[model samples]
Target: MRNLLVLGLALLLAGPASATEAEAWQALREGRAVLLLRHATAPGTGDPANFQLGDCRTQRNLNQAGREQAQRWGQLLRRQGIEHPRLLSSRWCRAQDTASAMGLGAVEPAPVLDSFFVQPRQGAERTRQLIEQINAQPRGVPLVLVSHQVNITALTGIFPASGEGLVLALPLSQPARVLGRIAPP
Candidate 1:
């Protein structure tokens, strides 16, 4: 499609700083990075007024394109030799669906990855909790966390597009550093 081509061109034009895409993938494969990905395209900014976490109908579920995009991301990871990373997702339906579509192993619900759109004050708290969780993760184990835009921004200071991911180097003693981003073609 024209849109996908345009997106690919844009990503190629706006490539990651210093580190190339290959290096980013290598870092991920080596388990030296953590991937924080925004949920795939849901065709809306936020959930509806009567949103309920238990029901997918009440939430903004992913469209066909979104589902395909998630599958492609999974394939990309596999191609990069990251077959079965520790997958975590927010409790929201959209996030859950995106994680499942990744074809990765079982997805564990992480409250720390929950969106703070309605309640802004929780963003910082949840971000801190997520950082602590990342720091505690066992070394040499890759991690992929699927969350909302707000949560991702709160954690990494990067606003990624739908299905886009930011690779971070999370050191145990120091703060997490953004290494680069991965936008599948």
Candidate 2:
């Protein structure tokens, strides 16, 4: 298992989508990688002008499709062999909602996963912190970080669509290797 995961991480671009996602799933299931997921289809670009943390009304929230997508993510992951992951989410309402809707387990708010879109200046620092945190995660534990596109892009250089997931190997290096994209289910 370790050898396959290591090989997958080393040559992430060597295979097709299904093979890539399969290896990515193996890494995730074995606690050798993480799923950096963007929040589900919150129908809007950014938050309202008066957006504030901790208040759902102030932010652009998940639409019905987004909610269902999140639920489907839960079902898909469970079916793919991940039942209860250490779910961490940004403080945004949409992110929290996505995490909650997954029904996998409890959701913890990690500041590093917060969106820095409106506050671009914070991206470098937050990304650095997020990388450090991910590096510190126990090697044998699966984790799921629910965040925004900005955060995901900053860490992985992948502009993920809403509800999309990128599987990254554990102990991430300078340039993170995205093992695969976990398409919305």
Candidate 3:
């Protein structure tokens, strides 16, 4: 299985940028994988002090470039025939918008994926909870989590930029490992 994953990663990276989404989709379709997506290109750091959860105007929302990237990522998924994925996201507006722009399906607001960037340091407990969530999914179907940079970095050990994503193959009785990263087309 590991060998297969390495081959897949090689193929993905070898292909043109426009092929990233399809390669990622194929990987997800073939394994019990979890997709950890960094929020789209919101050109800023943390949210403001007065940021509200639901109100986009009050939060650090996605910019025009971010929105286009998000939509394009979704389009790529659709092009690759990925459907009915279980979508999850951080409570932050940027993460939520990134997931929503996929237009794939209902996205659950998962606090486990919330950014630890605001905290003095990273939160291990929250990251563990998220890992548990991914591990708890039933067999079959793919899981996608749209989250902040700190949260994704804590989980995957790789700091992905906005709109970038990691595909991790999770075995039923073993730990999960990163397969490859998917950059926007």
Candidate 1 per-residue C-alpha lDDT over 7-118 given as tens digits, one digit per residue, 9 for 90 to 100: 9988887775434666766777778888888999899888899998898899889999999999998888888789999998999988889899989889999988888999
74 Cα displacement, candidate 1 (Å): 0.6
Kindly list the per-residue Cα lDDT of model 2 for residues 137-158, writing each as its tens digit.
7777679989999988888888
Instruction: State each candidate's clash count.
Output: 0, 0, 0
Top TM-score model: 2
Error of 1 at 136 (Å): 0.7
Candidate 2 C-alpha error for residue 37, in Å: 0.4
> How do all the candidates rank in terms of lDDT, highest first?
2, 1, 3
Clashing pairs in 3: none
* Off by more than 4 A, model 2: 1-17
Best by lDDT: 2
lDDT of 3 by residue, 1-185 (tens): 99999999988887875465456566687546777889999887898888777788888889999999988878877776667688988988888899998889999998888888778355677777777877777857777889887777776677788899888877412234776677764
The predicted structure with the larger lDDT, 1 or 3, is: 1
TM-score of 1: 0.85
Better of 1 and 2 by TM-score: 2
Higher-TM-score candidate of 2 and 3? 2
